[model samples]
Target: MGKWLLPESLADILPAEARRIEELRRLLLDLYRTYGYELVMPPLVEYLDSLLSASGGDMDLHTFKLVDQMSGRSLGIRADMTPQVTRIDAHLLNRAGTTRLCYCGSVLHTLPRGLWATREPLQIGAELYGHAGPEADIEVLQLALESVRRAGVADYRIDLSHLDVVRALLETDPAAAARADEIFNLLREKDVPGLAALGPDLAPATTQALQVLPTLYGDLDVLEKARAVLPALPRISQALDMLAALAKALPGVDIGIDLADVRSFNYHTGVVFAVYCGGWPNAVVRGGRYDDVGRVFGRARPATGFSLDLRELAGLLAPATASSAVRAPWGLEPDLAQAVRALRAAGQIVVQILPGHEHDQQEFVCDRELVLRNGAWRVEPLASAEPAARPSPSTAI
Candidate 1:
């Protein structure tokens, strides 16, 4: 025995699950295509050096490393796809001014705690590189909203945050930079008590501003509350003003302004946001700008992108109806096999029971079964198939 082996946190997307995911991917691709985003696929693995060039802080820890046998250089399983997409724009596509791309695939990331994270995750998303204004941001946001709607999802909230706000506040106090790392983690985890304990008596106004962040999630009113406490920080004020403009443009969409929400990855340079539905512990879609990330690849093209875990999103949507499930036949006469395949090709589910295994019909759950009668193909419901009969004893035979 090979020890009944499998990696602890890894999993295979079985036929049924893969089909469901593919359906979702097709719908999203169609919606994106309608909006002018061409589809692209980057490599699953990349040279370690190129991969690390823009992997921002939190992302660096999740990448899986290995050594390439032929090249003798380090290689890594991509933990995220945005870095690779940026590489494509800077090196291959090299679109002179602007380019829009959408992609769907699996990414690998190792988690220290094997239980909470998977080594492989399916990702589907879009990226808009070269454009840096809020208009581009709005387009991507609208695409995300439309994609989810196309996927049959409703009732979700978007958490909007400004990376510039947090960076501005920290830059003011030189000492704050040293504690920047700790502050980043605290804000992401929403550890209000931890943030309070680190206090060396921050400016009264700064203190008030920080306090508003934890509860800043929800509608546009959060901006007003933040403005009252945000201190003399001009960058913070400008960021808030931009957010206010977005709020005005996107009325009726649930939006929240979280001043304390920090970017998990250093590559995110400006506005950052995430989309979450009720009952999901984590956000389904997340994206932000990274003006400096492109420079890592030796080009400074401004960029922003977001991706969803297709597998997780499928879980939220109802699984395909039983009748729609795909199943291959056990075996069939050559002609019958061709006919069954043709039916399947036309969107009808087909299953063929093998000779001598005809009694095994109960083992296969399908809406319709294909069989041969009078030298022709016949289709019948699962309930009509006869259950396999038990073998007769030698004496009876």
Candidate 2:
């Protein structure tokens, strides 16, 4: 491979896409600030023990570990930013009431999630700490939806699930408890034959429940079908009720229920969801509640939030409208320099055409120019200049 060849599933985010991601980051961070989510930035690497303590269970496989020469203890590059932010919320802030926190940064995954996925993802998300009700869940859900909407993703959809439902069903049987891993895999794959293979050893009722999980997915009405089919256990019922409440809150919104949609992050204790956009084969965003993630840090708070790949979201957004530019001849004259600075400060894209250049200044789409017609620097529009095929000056940065 060439020296510049990037590893599979890892590529450079070029100028156009990088600018799009940066702009979206600013917009979403501002949105989070409005909701009282104070911004936080956790270190990219930390001691393996503190970094992975509780979440280390779910994150071990995805983390890249190395020995710290200074302490001789292992260190890990974070694969997920959630646990780090959780630690900060629990130990550093230690606020008594609810804490709203948000973060945006890059995380290094040991491997790509799928063939189409990136190993290094720009993860941006929000978390609500110290609140333990469906109310917080609803808030996070709304924020996640708004993120997609603001990105101009059309016809987006959401699929919601409660891990408690599956946990409730499994806790009922000793046999199911022993074979929990196998049962979980079978249900997730919706493998009826594999589940039936365990019928002789597993209870008939538990086997039946596991068999029905994969099919218990679809529109909101699927909840009705689930109520009729699944055992009328309190935990299961409670999970269903929460889903129903969300559906009611957002009428006509495309919401779905998938009882078997378990997340890889096992620390999550309650509701979980994945958001999708039109024509995408996989989810564009994902998150859920992980109340116990803070236990290792000595404070366990109810936390729910969603994270999306800024690069992916940027790719999904519609092309942004181009801004007109003012082409100015480069000079150190006080008036001209002041005009250039003023234009830029007032939010206009000003492209300064430099002096002593060996090349022609045909790069920018020069709609207007800073001219000195009346002794003072003045603004003038070009009479017959053709627009240049280039990215807006802002994006080029």
Candidate 3:
């Protein structure tokens, strides 16, 4: 392979794409701020113990580790920012009441999650700490929905599940982990024949319940059907109740319930949920209630949150039709230089032409041009292939 060739699943984000990501980042952080989620930026790398403290084995497998030259301790690049934020809540903030925290950054994964997945995911998320009630989970769910809405991505659905349901079933057969793994994989794959092949070793009732789980999806009626189909194990019953309540709370979103779905089950002790876009194979956002995540940090706070890949979300959203850019000739006069600086300060994307090179009209579609007009540097319209604005190009220019 060529030296410049990027590793598989790792690619560069060019300027046009990067602006969209940055715009979404700022918008989401502002949204989280409205909900009182103070921003915290954890480092990209940390000691292995801290990174892996609350995260489960799956995360460990994804994280990249290196020996720190100075400390000689194992350091790992974060594969997810949630655990790091949890540590912040438990150790640094140490607040007794509710703490709303949000973060946005890239996480390095050892492998791509899916065929088109990126190994370096630009993770943006919000975490609610010190609150374990269904209300907190509901609030986070609402936030997740709004995040996608704000990005202008439509036809998205949220699949809600409580791991406790599976835990309740699994508790019946602790020693049958091998059999349980087979069942879980079968359920994930939605392979009824595979599950049927392995059901004999499990209790007949458990087998029946597992069979119904793969089919337990769709609208609110799925929960109703689940009540009739699955056993009335206490924890499972409670989880179903919670899912029913969530369904009621989130009527606006196209919601589905997956009683058998257990993504991040070991890491998330309570409810686990994923948000999927229509026609997209993978869930764009995943989160759930993990109340015990902070315990290892010596302050077990109730925490629930969701994270979305910004790059993936940008892909889902409508392309940014209008971006900012103003062109100017090579600066010489003090007035021209001052005008360019002022334009930049005023938040206009100003591209000044260098002496040897002219501005690439295709790359930097200078919608507006800085020119000397009426003895003053003023913004003038440029004749372009596309109309920069409504009512045609300005006649004055």
Candidate 4:
């Protein structure tokens, strides 16, 4: 085995991709700031129980656990940042009113989510705490859409669902409720035959409802079909209404409904959403309302937010063009140093050509040069076909 080889699902990000990821990170953090979202950076690892407080079983399976060297308590490498941010809101801050928090960091998954996915995802997102209304959901959803748009994804759609829709139907039958985990898995997989197999154990109405769920996906019209076919449970109606409200709130954006897509059924408590772009088979962004996720921290609050893997999102966009830079000769002279410092201070990418590396290909495209002209340093455009091995100036510093 090669010493440089990483694990099966993990790989290093190269210079170009890393630069793109960093730019996107700064842009998104700035976007969140404008919306009054304060940035919070939770540790990459924490005590297992606290870390998984609100994330539920799905995150538990993905988290990498180890025994703490000092505390001797089990610690986990976070697979998600939401719960940590939730804990911060609940315990650390303990504010009486709204708290808008955003975070960007690495999360380690036990395995790759898909064939072409990275196990270590650079997760970035914003969360709104202390609001339980549809307004917060709408706000976060809009921010999510804006995030992809700003990232240069022209065509994308958001698929919305409410866990309570499934929860409502399952509550009608104890058998169905008991097998909730199994049913959720089946629904996520859209396994109609598996759902049918459970019919003998569940009520006839529950069986019918479970089977129809996979098909209840499309535009807003799916909600109408749901009302027509599913049982007339009040909770189900309320869930459907909430979905309608979300769709109504965002008029111009492309929205979708998927009652059967219970990917994070256990983690999310209310209206959940996943954003999809054309190039990626998986949802680029996922989030929703998880009211009372902070309960485990002794302060349950209504919270909603969304996160996306910057690495994956960066992959969807076109490669970033090389940044233009100013080429300067390497010298310790005061004038040369001052000139370079001035350009750097003015927000320019200045690449100093080393004594022996003048002809070496660089990541940056040096469009301008700092040449000593008339006994003073001056900035001028480099000739397009400048010779790689051009002779140095006779009056070299």
**lDDT tens readout by residue for model 3, 1-397:** 8899998899999877898999999999999999988999999999999999888665888999999999999999999999999999999999889999999999999999875899999999999998779999999999999999998887898988888877777788653455666666677787777767666677777777777788987877887798898888899889989988987898777988877687676688888889999667889999999887888999988889999999998988766665547778896788888888887887767888888776355445677777787888777776663465532233222
Q: Where does candidate 2 stray beyond 4 Å?
A: 320-322, 356-364, 384-397
lDDT tens digits, residue span 1-397, model 4: 9899989889898888999999999999999999999999999999998887677767878889999999999999999999999999999999999999999999999988875889999999999999999999999999999999999999899999999989998888999999999999999999999999998899999999999999999999999999999999999999999999999989998999999978877678998999999988888999999899899999989999999999999999999777777788999999999888888888878899989998888668777788998888877777762444232232222
Candidate 3 residue spans exceeding 4 A from truth: 174-182, 322-324, 388-397
Task: State which candidate, 3 or 4, has the greater TM-score.
Answer: 4
Q: Which residue pairs of candidate 3 clash? A: none
> What 10-residue stretch in candidate 2 is worst by lDDT?
388-397
lDDT (0 to 1) per candidate: 0.73, 0.83, 0.84, 0.90
lDDT of 1: 0.73
Per-prediction TM-score: 0.84, 0.93, 0.92, 0.96
Write one digit per residue (lDDT tens) for candidate 1, span 163-242.
87778877776666677788788787778887777667555444445555677766788888777767658998899888
Error of 1 at 9 (Å): 2.5
Please report the TM-score between candidate 2 and the true structure.
0.93
Clashing pairs for model 1 are 359-388
**lDDT tens digits, residues 1-397, model 2?**
7899998889998656777888999999999898889999999999998877868387898999999999999999998898899999999999999999999999999988754789999999999988888889989999998888887787889999888888888788788888877877777677878988988887888888878888899998899999999999999999999889987877768998888887653677888899988766768899888886898999877788889889878877776544467778887888888888888887877888777662464434567677776567666665544655332322111
Whole-model lDDT, candidate 4?
0.90
For model 3 the local lDDT of residue 119 reads 99
